[model samples]
Target: MTAWTMSDTGRSAAGGLPAGETAAQLVHRRLRDDIVSMRRRPGDVIFEKEIALEARVSRTPVREALLRLADEKLIEIVPKSGTMVARIPAEILPEIIVARAALEAVTVRAAAESARGSDIAGLRAIIERQRETLATGDIDGFHATDEVMHRAIAEAGRLPGLWSMIVQIKVQLDRYRRLTLPQPHRMERALAEHEAIIDAIAGRDAETAAAAMDRHLDGLRVSLAPIRDLNPDYFSGDVGAVYDRWAGEMA
Candidate 1:
């Protein structure tokens, strides 16, 4: 058995669960992160034997981890064929974008209205880091910074639930964004959008901040439109099939 100990985050040491639970939470987080970050992109086949051998755990725990991932929509558990990373629908893109736009707009507006000097300082610090990443042409770092910046805004807004929703949608949006990351001037344009958002918030102009966020989201959709049109296969078709399966329950 793997030695159990508390992780840095104070999670249940190695396994992060009861000694008799038979599954390691750390292993689950690792596997979940891999799929959510698109390291395991949509439609990639996942073999239980392979995962079990790699995690050094039994297939039972690996299966447990996979079930958790499927529940999060990061991976799909196909009947008999095995679990694969989910290929979400293109429609989910716009839906997520819309949700992000609304929530982020509200977040920024709230941040502007209620932010303390320290909150503003923290946001500025994050933006400066984002600027440095862009200057260094660190594409992955920029993505990381971008994720942090938005989360900061949501946090400053004091709406943790809304922030959680953003986290969920971001997993899907990020895959599309990565496809457009190589486009010429994309980073510069993204920087400009971030600057506009920050400036409006700093100026304490809620309307301007909300409008700026909407524009940013609209631009994201525009940039991805061509790529989305070109690559229809990037998302999973299983989403619809799953929907059909659950439609009766939903109805």
Candidate 2:
């Protein structure tokens, strides 16, 4: 895990405070970013006083921040003991994957029908940028650029709203996907998959583009067993919460 310091805690997510953003919000963003990026690994203890001191704020705001993180399940708050970073709820990942794949496949299919020369050019440009970023060993930048590729595809398909929906559903999945970056050839294979999808879209083959996209997204689903096995500590053992959440969604 990457180490963060007290000095790093004072700054808000974007270098400075945005209008009306409070101390608690800033601290929450800092902690959330650290947790999601695996800088603060699963089961790492988080103390209110330490966080308060780091942010140069009273414990009230820090406590509030921690509570918010708990609500997101990014951190677990133990009433008597202490708070700790939450493990990945591996149970929910399959459902998340299914939702994303279904949505993205539709978007890619639509993009194949709607794609213009400019759209194709823009996607190719993103691919070039991803390649350049990956070459520099900036895996995070490469992954970010890869997301732009998906967003561009959604926009090209005239279904930009669906991309926002995708973003909303991907919060937990993002943390899991971040772990996949350093795996040998993971990023390369993803890039190749993107290329295949773009090729099909460029050819105006809607069905082929959708199939390529399904295959691309399915890669993450297939990765679960190996990734979970390799990093058992990173995942939650109890899957009941996932089943409960799904049932609640239906009700």
Candidate 3:
């Protein structure tokens, strides 16, 4: 029998849940992080009973959390077949990149116009943290800092809503990206691209910042083909299958 409790996590520690966080909310956050970070893994079986036992929570909250994740498409619950983490959607990746690149360019341009010296410094700090994570070969840690770098630019522009929207749309992209990070010189190249964006923003060059952001995001769109070829099972089938699944859901 497992003796560990949910309090072991920082947010829901023995001290108590943060503000309005319920057990369901806490469970949802943990499971979502596991899914997005690829700790749970694509197509891996996810038993609610096991998760509830590990969290020491009642099945009600666990059910609620799983339902929420299903809504996010992080986990797909099949009729009579149980649930598994959703595979990355290769067909929609480029569409997502196009949308994200446009929105991100807006944010970086705004950041160039509005960012103070302190904001630039904060972004530099995040990149520096990424530098450390890369040196240690810590892919997840490096990716977390990469998120901070992008979100920092959005926040620096006072457009946190844009970042919030991006977060919602990027979870699928993230699963694919985590795979890309392990490729040769990938993390190093990403760090360099981040530096270029910061330089443009620090110089208060909005056009240059947007262009740099474009080049940065475009790299992912370009990497999709090679990475998908290498990890075919990690992605869903081509457009027809992807459309069928989504269409069935909406029916």
lDDT tens digits by residue: candidate 1, 1-251? 12222442234535445444445564577676666555676778888888766655678878788887777777878796777878756556666777788788888999889877788888899889989998898877898898888888888778767888888777677777876766789888888988898888888898998988888877766665466555667765544443344333334
RMSD of each: 6.7, 4.8, 5.1
Give the per-residue lDDT digits (tens) of candidate 3, residues 51-169: 87777778899999999999988899998999999998777776677789989999999999999999999999998899999999999899989998999999999899999999888
Tens digit of per-residue lDDT, candidate 2, span 1-251: 43345446555555554457788887898898888777788899998888777677789988899989998889998889888999998787878888999999989999999988999999999999998887888887887898899999999999999999998888788888988888899998998999999999999999999999998887886676667767878989654455456446644
TM-score, each model? 0.79, 0.84, 0.89
Q: What is the lDDT of residue 168 in candidate 2?
A: 82
**What ranges in model 1 sit over 4 Å off?**
1-24, 236-251
Model 1: residue 175 alpha-carbon error in angstroms: 2.6
lDDT of 1: 0.74
* lDDT against true structure, model 2: 0.84
| Total clashing pairs for each candidate | 6, 0, 0
Show the colliding residue pairs in model 2: none
Using TM-score, give the best candidate's number.
3
